[model samples]
Target chain A: MSRVVVDVVLKPEISDPQGQAVLGALGRLGHDSVRSVRQGKHFVLEVEGTPDEAELKQIAETLLANPVIEDVELHLPKD
Target chain B: MRIGVITFPGSLDDVDAARAVRLAGGEPVALWHADHDLKDVDAVVLPGGFSYGDYLRAGAIAARSPLMADVVAAAGDGMPVLGICNGFQVLCEAGLLPGALTRNSHLHFRNRDQVLVVERADTAWTQDYRPGQRIVIPVKNGEGRYVAADADLDRLEGEGRVVFRYAGGNPNGSSRDIAGVTSENGRVVGLMPHPEHAIEDLTGPSTDGLGFFTSVLKAVVAA
Candidate 1:
């Protein structure tokens, strides 16, 4: 089995409204334990066949995310 | 002149952007996200879409692409770079520009034709239009709001970096109704509107967006 991991982040200095809203909601929910909240997503896939690391990186870069506002890192399981 | 359009993962508008470039009398070069070579294009355009599925943040992931390193270097060398929507996010994420795009204040994915006033006509992307001219373009995105500190906003305004401001209603709750902006040198521009989708009148919102493409061509030729 082949596994691919995708990591993402917002561009630095760009405000994250989603994170702010979540933080507000946390305060209301009495989870004030949360000091800061930043929202982001991740994707992990298992493919049938082996694909080169470059190709997987390309896939993650082109169709998997928007480069303008999102940052991504791709990791493959070690052989 | 050849214009390179970078295609990042989740990029939805590279094809349209390339077509617009071609329609505006420039050869469109397709640049892959993994490739470091810019193929010797005169200018570069980072198109819109949900790169990395808007994961970590809009344009944040894609900004680190190997290809972007070249873009940043070239842009610093004064090669014109235009980032539309997601592309704009990438520009900001890549540190090629300032400010960040946040989610719409309404928290809804907005897609509509927007009217914007030309705030700056001296940039490579807006040179075709006169200052204060109003134009319509399509804007579709969930994270389209713009935000910056008070001092940064003041600096931008003082330096005349504001490039486009919403003319009618603010569609995405952008700060000061800002729709676009330019770098200090005026060679790099980033806007939330989709100019590529506005190039063709038959199928798109308005033809006003065509001027952006044509403007870049003129600037390149004159330079």
Candidate 2:
């Protein structure tokens, strides 16, 4: 089995409405010092069967990650 | 025809998406964000929702889901993929399609019935419509502004990949009034409007969105 890790981050300068909303709520709740909050997701997968690195990369580029607004990284642990 | 609807942790439209697929005469398969299997579906629909609670950006978190790995592979092998609303955001973020969705110029969440001009009818999700036809669908989002480098915009326009454009007035201040776009091969499509919500006249503003689903079915049959 091969394990792949995918990380998705928003592009700079793109205001995250959800994050901003959260920040506003936080301030309202008396939590200061949280200047900003940007949210993202991390995905880890364990694929059964032996797939080559090229195939894994293809998966990351095409479906697993959006290249325009987000960047992704794949990690294959050595057996 | 089995179509897969991917459900990210915060996905809100998978059920509606499945209903639309079923109404359009296709089976809807539920795919999880943490699963790698695509369930051998024919097509895939990345429904709009606050995936990962719209963290970092809309669709940014959900783009890295486990199922997306399989989705990317299937899309490359000619499997049709449609990204709607947040789904469209995910598609752009994932780099499956060009451009990025930014905050609405008004910096507010706008939701209303929107009129769209069909610019490209050859794509898998738009074949049922004629070029220049105008259809009304609902669009609701906060970060729905579409942006791209000037050169990229020119290339997208030059290549005829600008599949849908807003008519009458720009709702979200999208550049060039773009509402939807397709990949170079026309296999992948992403639109900012919610077609799944417009499939039924009684429930939605219009049934114009049904054509998108029917169009894909026809494309599959023809292929």
Indicate which candidate wins on TM-score: 1
iRMS values for every prediction: 5.6, 4.4
Q: Write the per-residue lDDT of candidate 2 for residues B1-223, one digit (tens) a residue.
A: 8888998888889999999999999888999889889988888999998888876667877777778878888889888999999999988877789998987877789999999999999999999999999999999998898988667899999999999999988988898999999988898999999989999978999999988788888877776
What stretches of model 1 exceed 4 Å from their correct place? A1-79
Docking class of 1: incorrect
The lowest-lDDT stretch of 10 consecutive residues in candidate 1 chain B is B143-152
DockQ of each: 0.15, 0.17
DockQ, cand. 1:
0.15
